[model samples]
Target: MLADFESKHSLYFDFAGARPLQFVNPPQQLEVKAGQTARLLCLFTGSPPIVSCWIRNKEQIVDGPELWTENTDQSSSLVIAEAKPQHTGYYTIVVRDRKSSAQHTLTLSVIERPEPPASCPVISCVTASSLVLTWSGPCYDGGSAILGYAVELKEQGHTEAGDWREVTDLCTSTSYRVCAGLRHQGEYCFRVRAFNKVGASDPGPVSPVVRMEQRVSAKPQAGEAPKRPTCVTMDSSNKVKDHYIMQEKLGVGKFGQVFKLTHKVTGQVCAGKFYKGRRSKEREAARKEIELMNYLHHPKLVQCLAAYDHKPEMVMVMEFIAGGELFERIVDDNFEHTEPASVHYMQQILEGVAYMHEQSIIHLDLKPENIVCVDTTGTSIKIIDFGLAQRLDANTPLMVMQGTPEFVAPEVISYEPVCLATDMWSIGVICYILLSGESPFQGNSDTETLALVTAAQWEFDEESFDEITDEAKDFISCLLNKDTRRRMCCKEALAHPWMAAFDSEDLATTKCLSKEKMKRFLARQKWKKAGKAMLALKRMALLSKGDSCSSPTSPGEKSPLSPEAKHALKSLEQKMQGPPHFTQCLEDQTAVEGSSVSLSCHLTGYPDPEVVWLRGEEPLEESSAVQIEYEEDGRCNLVLAKVSMEDANVYTCRATNNHGETFCSAKLAVKQ
Candidate 1:
């Protein structure tokens, strides 16, 4: 059983007055002429004294060449010599004691001469069919008030004789816009002069001649003409033809034609793309090419200098690479003797591909023809033809089949959802071609190539590639894995032992090659270790079961008991007892002096009981002195601080929350 009760009480306090205080009279306003001396003062009175200060703008005034200050029991003053506008604004006087402070505000105004207005220069000019005039204003002279300004303009090659227009109503703070109607297709020069109330200054130099073109309006007959559909024109005499200035024609492909062009201005060379305009789809393809070039920024990717959108014609300017495509270098030129350089170049290509994937950009087309050496040095490879590039956001679902048939992943060929893994698969095919100089999977026709991709059927003869390193083969195998989940990503492929060989010659010749072979042989061994780790985790989870097991706690482990655990235990115990009830306080007391005091008691029952507070033997109510604080779940607190003798008896606390109730007592002691 538990006893419950509540009570209330009142608390009060008083303080004794100290010694007599003093009053100070602060200055109302302090006026100081420029280059003159001025002093600020404050007066006060009191016994034993007080500290005073000269405060300016709520901050203490310090002693300097311009500002000198002194303080005493009678008054405090701050002296200022050669006071300027910076010395203007408000000042203050402050007096303070151990317990309180007094302050006053004083306005300090300094008289000085007005600053001169600065001269303004012409900032910019815009030419329309009409305007051949210019305007000017001031920057900031000496801050003097500007009354107004004057304007003037004259044609070029004309002597000191010309009409000078004067507009007196001009604001100094802003630039002036001058518009003078002039003949179209004619060049005219102009100059502007500025003036202030003080006087007019010299005129600024004349501006260069501005030639405005005449505006033409469309006639009814011209508007009736049919609008041309944007297309890629093959004729070399078009608008872009003059810009590109084809020097020589490169090899043509099913996709488009590339031509070498020399920029007339920079005298630099570039490649111009001229897509075949036989179909409407070709026009759409032209836009995709420009979009791809604008999004990709990498050293290894082809740089798009400019794109022309002439109706019924489109052209893309790209960096001219004389080294040609990798396919031509390896197959057409027979570069087996240059195998090392070729392999290194292929590694750079893979690096670019990896970077594209990391940026969530997919280069759907990956082939040797798209990979070209960008410079005569043959040190850089460029990935071109981004007509099929697509961005993949983090949440984008993998779907829709895309890319060339032969390089497409198995999922993509089967019309299933394909992700960046599909790109990796294409890169694997590219790597295979670069190392072996032969397509890993090819057919007599496009239909056959796609069939092979769908079936995931590709032939790789170790005998035919005996000269090829095992490390290279392992990397390709990881990327071409049939399962997307197990397939090696672009990042993982770049970190493979085969790619690592590019960094170390010794590793390339020995360790990486051996490691690749060992990996193939010990594939099952790694899986066995993974299996053991999983089993161990499962057994540990099963062994830890009961609530009172008192499992071995690791260092710094917090209490394993949860709030739900305590709730469950309390519920069970309360069922063993009966309905809950409140408890009464046996006694209560308060302290007259001190900072903190405590109240305590014991709670007993089948279920762990809670404690609450009360002033007297009645149910406790909340007030400033008595507080019913709570701690961890199911634990109640009765905290009383700043104890006076009034708080010196037993305090009652009733704790019950669906659990059986219990009463607790607290004894408080007040210190003198």
Candidate 2:
């Protein structure tokens, strides 16, 4: 067979001198500053007519503006011009022939510190014993999260550098209250410094001197009558209840609850999203979503009818679609799903996405659950859920770390700048699942799923894609490319061969696709969603109850701890005795290669704390080789079945409850 193939196509191969591809000089990992150029060169030995290609995030690279490639028979070079933070990721060089292939992978890190605060700190409140300071965050985060702020204080009339002292090394929030060392009748100046993974930024401008006195008051002007205090009230008639009659609950979301509603005047039925929290921050976030939805107008997109601000709560009226979600229809026994059907849905999704892109909008969350049908027949489709949608312009680039792990784009997982291609990646995943009835990147846990996405580890399984056409697979591959630059845009995807053949009268288009795998996928998604929703609601309730621990003792039966303990015991005393605290923290350990290892810690908190294990910044989830155990008596353990060099890192155990949260970290060393 080999001789026959070589004889037939002798021009593309050298059968006599062919050698397996080998990398003589593989590319090395790189660490470069943003805006700097980076180049990766690889030299290899292979048969004649060897082909070399560059890939990043599973996407093949070609000669382009930002990224360009140069290749010869046995060598390749990938040059990244004016590399930005978004370009930080893994890059691979592959040299291959008809019979053999060699590849090398390397990571590129872009380092930069966040900018200082936008403006000088301001004094929000001044009291006799404490001073409250607030400042705006930096305009640019330098491609990483702004972990916290550092507050520094300098007493007035002090010129020496030693006069300035640190108020707090880490202030997670933008506002900080200085009550511990502040003294009455003292004057001080404050400045803030923002920090991220890279390091702390330059200190912002110093604030105006704040004079703390025993009392602050202003006297009325002489010969002038004192003005009466003005009062404002909300009109009861303006409440959402007065305009709409809320009906049965439809669904619950992270930030709000959806309900079926009917307009009182028009008697038109619609869906209303009522924010779950009455706090000002939650209401503001709800208002932002509603405003964005109302501003966007399209047939394929859900429309926001009206918005109502009823005091501390916000309600948004949305178009009510009778048909269920996209996946629900796919899993329905009565629904006839075929290659053409999947294409039909994907075309509609592409059209909606194209419109959003034209309007500078990117729907960060574009999963099967967010796409719904117009009616039971499933002819028309509407893209719902704008909770994570963002608008990006020429000047503003958004970096976010929030999305469904299974469908998130590689850049999102890396916290890189998001582009229109980000949504296209999710669209590709959706298309893959629509035709195959299986998710390409789903794993046993979120951590694993995210790892799969970052690596772009997916393939066309024979079992799932046996009947799938090459055109369909090509379409999905174009969108799922890890390199956002190479990924297809909405218009390009809509113009793909598979989508163009939506109405074709062919076997591949007419054949019914099996739904067995899809049904299972739907069931698994529902189960996971249920668990997450329950946890979120529980956490919300706990947080809303304030930062006080519930006592373990029942009323009138306390033997005694202290008056402070008795006072801390609120209404729900049976749930807990006191706030959570750590009895012991994790310690550094050493283990041999391929050996089982366990890290144990002791925790004691009222109302049982929720524990999370993390390796570096990445979370560790329960898997075949990983197991987590906790006991009623505050015993916690993390077990690893087979340890490897990759397991060597700083491991952290974070425990959280309504009362407070604490964490401890230790290093793990693995030896061969």
Candidate 3:
């Protein structure tokens, strides 16, 4: 029976040693999440069954609950279950047979999952149609940090019950709203859950049924905020030029400048906001802007078509509004704003604001500047700038007062609880200026203006309002009321008599703004535009000078490899040779401190190789002073900006491909 088995399975034996016993294949590098089973296998030639053992860090491993061993005549495997970080590192398998013995090594990496949230999230407040939820972080990190949280809602009464629908929006903030897709007066239960890399925990204990119409006033509870994704950083490798043709910069926005970009295929124009997260708040603010624009859709709002999370920064592409700011047309060189036109603008503004409020979004910054004109006709208005926006219950006291001072409400100045009425006050200020061409709360300086605003000091300028009607004055007064509760919200303001006359024949023909008023408005706007531009320029200068470690290549620039390097690589494929081999290996080099130098390597081999310039195993950072130059012939050079003692290291130029890899290294010395 044994002789018959040997005759049938002769492929496993090396008869007469036709080929020397050798490793046909060996285990490769492995990566796995913690708690998962990891198995490494190695194949050998000519074996009845080789005695094999697994070793980590030179220590022989033993079989147990977390580890097991398996072997066949030709191959062997070492298995590790419930792998942990300690299991990570270099591991080797030694195999011995009657003919010969072989040893193979590989690397294993186990990633640890983050722990669940330290504490459960709490419900902050609820309004007629919205429910707000907030949470703090988990006590232990587990291994990975918290990525984001999900707010789930379910109706209480059910036999089998439906699945929980997580709020599907881009926001990663501790505070988020569940107003959409909800019935106005229905009773719904909510649960807040947090998740990390490994998986999610069971939803926190469910909450009592919340009626949609229930009104509650509350502030953000004090707690340890979760480690949310506040910043999305980037490097020189992130580029947008491949698909976009950047045109003129529109202007600086709340977080960064808005650029005019045209698509490569469609040739369509759009405004793109490219932001670098220098501060955590800046990153959070940018994230919120994207989240708000992602789900909002209205004729009165600038549409965000798509967003690109291009590492190093986030790029938001929005529908381009061509005409520019509303003030631009309202203060045109030959501007004439008819009362009907002003009414048209205001109607659109209120409709936009009404829609925003319906969606539980508070436009904290509302002013003539934030409103944009769709075209030169002043027919369409779009609201822009949402830097200070937030989602809150209708009556919640927002202690943080942030908005244009001239337009801020008295409640804001007193550091009291603020609500949607704060936005109404700003709108009122905008309307007052639009009708009278004189700021109702204008003062000598910001301090005096703020003081006057706090006192709610303002009156109709007799000369400016001589021709204005009482209905318009009444509409403005109701919104400017210091008692926020008495103030007319967008819905009520849109129903005023003056607004009712917006479509009348006579009113349509009467120009609301005179030539003298427009000229002054235009001058002030020009100054503001100039001031904003200067500020943006200064910011750009600072960003460029801030990172001195390495100067980065312009993301827009093309590769700078030399033609010779290109030729070498192309010729290598045609010429018969082994894997990439270095022709001129790097040599020891010395440089004077503060002096510049370049190190070059000449290489040739089959299948063009990708060469990485490195200091030890660390890749180099491209900067203005230090650059890596390449040629088609596989020649690579490292150019130093200014060599310093700190720059001394063992420099290496490693080239690799499918077949094999070759490297040439040398010591770099910088003298005093």
Q: For each candidate, C-alpha RMSD in Å?
A: 24.6, 27.3, 30.2
Give residue 509's lDDT in candidate 3 (0 to 100). 62
The per-prediction tally of clashing pairs is 34, 4, 21
Candidate 3 is scored at a TM of 0.45
lDDT minimum window of 10 residues, candidate 1: 220-229
lDDT of 3 by residue, 145-241 (tens): 3555667777656434466677653435555677687788877776655566666655665666767777543321222111111212222343456
Over 4 Å off in model 2, which ranges?
1-237, 506-509, 530-672
Candidate 2's TM-score reads: 0.48
**TM-score of every candidate relative to the true structure:** 0.39, 0.48, 0.45
Against the unseen true structure, what C-alpha lDDT does each candidate score?
Answer: 0.54, 0.73, 0.66
Error of 2 at 276 (Å): 2.6
lDDT of 2 by residue, 294-338 (tens): 335567998766566766667776788889898898778887888
Predict model 3's lDDT versus the native: 0.66
Global lDDT for candidate 2? Answer: 0.73
lDDT of 1 by residue, 319-355 (tens): 7777876655544323332335545765687667765
